[model samples]
Every structure is written in C-alpha cells, then in structure tokens.
Target: MIRTLTEKEIEISGEKKIYGTLARPASAYTDEKFPAVLMISGSGPLDRNGNGPKGKYQLNVYKELAEYITKLGFITFRYDKRGTGKSEGDWISTGMWDLVDDAELAFKFLQNHPQVDRDKIIVAGHSEGTIIGTALSERQELNGLMLLSGGVGNLHEFTTYQRMLTYQELKNSKGIKGLLMRLLINEEKAETKTQKQTKKIIESNKDVYKILFFFKQPAKWIREHFAYNPRVGLKKVTYPVIAIHGDKDGLVDPSLLEELSSLVKGPSETHIIKDMEHGFRFQYEQKSMVNVKKMLKVLPSRPLNPDSLGVIESWLTKYFKADVSSDIKENA
Candidate 1:
C-alpha cells in the first residue's frame, strides 16, 4: 500500500536565513522516525525546484528526486542556495566554501529533526553538489553518499573541456564569425594576452565578452571551484558511496565514475546510464545548433530519463537499505 507523504516549508539559519522543503512519510498517531536524504543542486542560479533563470530552462530535477525518494520511505530535504530562489543571500559573491558551509548547516538541521533517524542520513548531490557532498562525507559520519553526474577530476581541466565543447558547438553553428572569435580568445593562449589586448578585442562585442569573462569565467566562485578536486576529498570518505554518470553527459566526462569509485575506501559502486544526459534527461543531440535551440525551447515539456530514478532507487535499496515497499503519500 502507498502511504501518504507530507512536505513542509522549513527554514535553516546559517550566515543568512536559508529556506527549504522538508518531506516525510505521514503516519496517523505515531512519533516514528525514518531515514533521511539531503538533496543539493548542481551549479548556477538554480531555484529549489532546479529551475534555472527564467529564459534558460526549467528542469524541476531536484524536486522530482526529492518526491521520488520520499515515496521510498525516506524523509528528504532540498533547499535553495544562498542568493537563489527563496533563500536569502547574494548568489554571485558566494564562493565554494560558502556553499559547503550551507550544506553542512542543512545536514545538521536534518540530523536534529525529531522525525529523522539521525544515524541513517544520506547526502545526495548532483553535478557541483557532488563535490560538496563528498567533502561533507569526509568531515561527518553518514550512512551513505550519492553522486549524480559529478566530476572527479581537476576543476580547471573540466572547465576547459566544457569551454572548448561550447566553443566548438558555436563554431559549428555560427560559421566563420564563431570560429574567428574562438580563435582570438583561445583559452590555451589566454595567459599570453595582456589585459589591454584582451579588453580591446572583447570590446568589439561587449555583451558576449562580459558573459564569457567577468560573469562566467573569471568570477570569484569560478576561481575557487576551479581549485577544488573531488578526488582529493573522495579519498578520505570511509562510507558507502554510489556514483552515477550518464554515458552521454556533455558537461562531465563519464570516466569520472571510474576515478571516483576507485578513490572510495569503503564499498563503492558506479553506474553509467546509457543515452542519459547531464540533467538525467533523454539524450539530445548537442552537436547540432538547431537541435540545441529546439531542445532548450521545449525543455519544460521534456520527460526525465526513466532509468535514472530506478537506478537510484535500486542502489539505495541494496546499499542503504532504504525501504521501497511502502506506499505512503504526503502533501506539501
């Protein structure tokens, strides 16, 4: 039988007042506790529902994950990072450590909750969140850790790879203009160009230049994130870890799953979802600019990769012993 699940708006105080959703199985006259999972989003200005900026896209990925896990008899919590969604704080000014601190606060809040089985808390992080989750596992004692489409190599190298791929896509679509621009701002030769020379060339297209340089590339958070290597922290975690990556993930390399699994001293397992993309969506043609544009326009209607959730459920059931036989439903 499917049981009821209840979700409540929760506030966690940190450097600022952080807002989140706490979900649990609803039971009629019992003070029973259950295992809990904390969900952390990837990167950028994503809201609690995993929706990016208005015109970008709305995936609702994290929210779906929370609801799905809650149905499996585990209380789940997910929050908006500082400066995004309902949370209070400045988003752009926050660095890597700031995010880690916020996650730690959320973990403590879940651990202390009366309806949570403190010993059975699991930290599930996606993309950039995987780094934070792995780092937290090293510092805290936890029952399990889950990494979804997370990176395991050097941040700088990964950033470069992503940059090149994007540039290549643009070149393929924009033809000569894109090729010329990319050649001029070659990341490999970025160090050789003086500030004045770089500024002069970028001034020709200030909008794109600012986005690539000031906003996305050279920001404080980017620098700090670039310095972090998940492998370093994964080496210290002694708890069971499940790392899942999509075979078609464009942002992170699939090989990271092997690197991550090899570092974990505890029992570790890796899964590669065939034809799944970075956000656990059906694999879309990223190489073609026309396909990319069409996919972005219809993203809200796109269904998630069905296999993704099943994999997570089965892994949790086998490793974390999360009860999947329950049928409780709770309203938020």
Candidate 2:
C-alpha cells in the first residue's frame, strides 16, 4: 500500500506564539494514536523548514528528516526559532533557555494532538538542538532522543577545541594566505583576545552586545549556552538515546559519540558516518568552518547521506516499534 501524508501549518502558544508544520500519516486509524517526533533545529536564524534568513542558507535538513520520518508512520513537528520565519521575538536577544522553552512547548503541542501517542513522543535535535533536547529530557519524559552532530560537552569547551583545529589548519596553509596569516596573527594574542571577549560577554547584563561598534550578537544567549553543561542532564536521561555524527563534522567532534552514549543510563547507540558533514550531507573535500559558507552554498544540492538516514531508521525501529499503531506498522 502506498503511504500518504497529511500536513498542517500549526501554532503553539507560549510566552510567544510558535509557528511550525506538523506532518503525519494519512491512513485511517480513528482509534489509534501514532508515535510522534519533535525536531529541534541547530543554532541559527532557522525557520520551520530549516532554511535560513532570505534563503541565504537552504540546508533543509529538518524538513527532509520530518518528511522521511512521517512517511514511516510517525507524526513530526519542526518549528521556527524565535524572531525567524513567522515566529515572534528577537532571535538576537533570545537566550538558550528560551529555545528550550520553545522546544518544551512544541513537545506539549505534540502530546496534546489527538492523533499523537503521548507516551511515544520523541525529541530529535541536531547540533545545538542536541543539547537543548538533552536539557528538555530533564524536564519532560520523552520515549527517546536522537542527537545529530552533537556530543557531550559545554559550548565553551567545544568552541575552544574547534578554534584550535582551525588554527592548526591555517598554520599549515601552503600559500600567500598562509604566509600573511602567520605573519599577522599571533596565536597567543588571539587566544587572549578571545578570552577577554568571552569574559566581557559573560559579565554583561545586555541581551545583545555590539562587536566592533557595529556587529551585534546575542550576548545573553552566548553566556547562557557557554555555561551549560549537558552532562548533568544527560546523566539523568534514562530513556533510550541514539547519537549520530559525521566523521567530517568540523563543528562537533565525532569521537565524543562514545562518551555521549555512555552517559545515558538507558540503552544507547552511536554512529559516525564517513564523508558526511555537520549538515547531514556528504562533503568529499576537506571540511572546515573557514569554508562553511562556500560548502553550504552546495550542500542544499546534495542529498542527505544514506547511511545517516539508515541509522536513524534502524535505531527508531529498534527502540520505538511498539509506539507505531498496527495499521502504520503494517504499511512499514
């Protein structure tokens, strides 16, 4: 039998109105409630469809994942971050906890859906969402969690490690750019400047901070995230968890998958796919944040890595098969 999907544009009321799309199997099952997945996007001014501002970034990772999982008989909800898309508030001023609140509200929206199985709801987060979902799991009892491109460290520690890797790559560059960088940039001074900037942000009381007297950043958000330790909440997560990272994911260390999985008190699994980047697409070239903009320009054209999707399918089936209704399972 061919499976069809029913999608609806919905809103969840909270401190601010949250806009999102919910997709579910269209099969008739009046007395049955299907398992559901709430998707939390990575850090960015991203929309419900996972596109960035004015189509500058069009990696539709969450949208594709939601559609794929919905086809597998699960209802999936992906919402816009505050101040982005049709959602309310200022993204630049929104703190990390605010994102968590929005996610919780999205979860409650799923739980309250007539066709959703309250006990079978799962939260799947990518990159930044991984930590947010972990934090949410501490607040809500989720059936399962899927952490993509994220591991078990605070943002501060992770960013410092990423800087080190980028520095090493730049230090080894083989041309004029390398010569100029080495001549003009002192690693020790760079580190000191970064430390000073971080200290300023942490001590600031402003919601937004101006850098270079022009560029604005979400100071409160950075402050909150830098201090957040996912280990505390992850250690309390007794629910099944599956973490997937790409071997080429430059933003988050893929090797941390082992530590992340081990922290979960419940059954857990991890996968590190080759050539896959943080965006879930395959990138055969050297992956670096320095070339992120250039890479993102081509990422939307590339399809998601088959192995990553397969792992998600396999893990969900293994741990949450009972959550799917009989008719939906039959179709699968």
Indicate the TM-score of model 1.
0.83
Provide the overall lDDT of each model, using Cα atoms, as 2-decimal numbers.
0.74, 0.85
Cα lDDT over the full model 1: 0.74
- For residues 1-332, what per-residue lDDT tens digits would candidate 2 score against the true structure? 12567889998889999899999777666566788999998887989878889967888888898888887778899999999999999999999999999999999889988988888899999888998998898899999999988968768867887897788778778899888778877778899999998898889999999988998978989999988899888899888898898887889866667687668899888888999999899889886877778898888999999999899888777776634454555566
Q: Assess every candidate by TM-score.
A: 0.83, 0.95
* Highest lDDT scorer: 2
What's the distance in Å from true for residue 195, model 1?
A: 12
Residue 223, model 1, lDDT: 53
Residue 320 in candidate 2 has what lDDT? Answer: 67
Question: What range of 10 consecutive residues in model 1 has the weakest lDDT sum?
Answer: 200-209
